[model samples]
Target: MKEKATLIVVGTPTKILDSYEKQHAPFTKYKFHLSKVYKGDGEEGTEIELLQDGNKDASYNVHPLMEVGEKYILFLERSSTGALIMVGGPAAKYKYNKEEKVFESIDGGRIDEHLERK
Candidate 1:
């Protein structure tokens, strides 16, 4: 079985974000690698840079990518019934170049699609 967090987001729900947080009060932030982003479409959306530690929001690039800090990431919460509810969709995944501080996506591999198909 997969590990359970306080909340989780499956498929992708644009409207369900606020409700999920309201349900998980004192909302905490959970950061993931940001494998992908879906613009409510089946095709893979733009990829955001990944940071070892960063916020998922804040808008740095011209593209709608989440910032890397701590507060912007999504948090997962578990319900009283012991089911995991999705808190939020996280930032897109970018490669972490040790030498370079900037976060950027790799040449042509997408992670979100891989996860979805799985």
Candidate 2:
């Protein structure tokens, strides 16, 4: 079964939990795709709604890493490892809107994926 992400938050660039040392996370954003929201797993992110292009690549232009509405809000800051860290409040959260038959990202994620992309 396919699922969709619920919450996509853009928090200050922080270190993603990795082995060895605690360095800043690579991605410019801290996207929270809740399993509960997508009915998926911890490994693969929640299944995103496919674009009209028929592409199934996990990576998409609508990467929540990109700031929404404004540009400065999601700008990236270089980390020690050259990884881009996010700044500002991209902190988004969401719930499954069963009534609408789609995931609703409170912050950013679930939406008109079939029609929109960054």
Candidate 3:
């Protein structure tokens, strides 16, 4: 049940902030500058926020991918409030090198194909 995901997007993380929910539970919010939409609406130029539960003790397997200004291929799941959050923790995150045109997985594997560009 860890690998469940529905949407994928390639974008640069522009900003991040730590915030709390109603009961003071911490969560991280990431704002992304979308470049390529791989599985959802292919609209670019819009910024979107991805939120993840930050309480490690009872988190939804949320891992930190908080490198602002870095490009990433992110696997996400939509919340009831229309926000997107990382899915499957670190496994759903991939660093994208625009210079070399490659996607590097969290486990250090280079993924060059099986992802639709544009």
Best-matching candidate per lDDT: 3
In model 3, the clashing pairs are none
Q: Model 3 — which ten-residue stretch has the worst lDDT?
A: 55-64
Clashes of each: 14, 8, 0
Off by over 4 Å in 3: 1-4, 21-26, 53-62, 80-82, 98-100, 113-118
- Give one digit per residue, the lDDT tens place, for model 2 in 43-90: 233322111111222223533432222211122233445443322223
The most accurate candidate by TM-score is: 3
lDDT of 1 by residue, 10-98 (tens): 22221212111333232223233332332222223322211222223332242233333311222344455543323322333333333
lDDT of 2 at 85: 36
* Worst-scoring 10-residue span by lDDT in model 2: 47-56
In angstroms, how far off is 5's CA in candidate 2? 13
lDDT of model 3 at position 74: 79
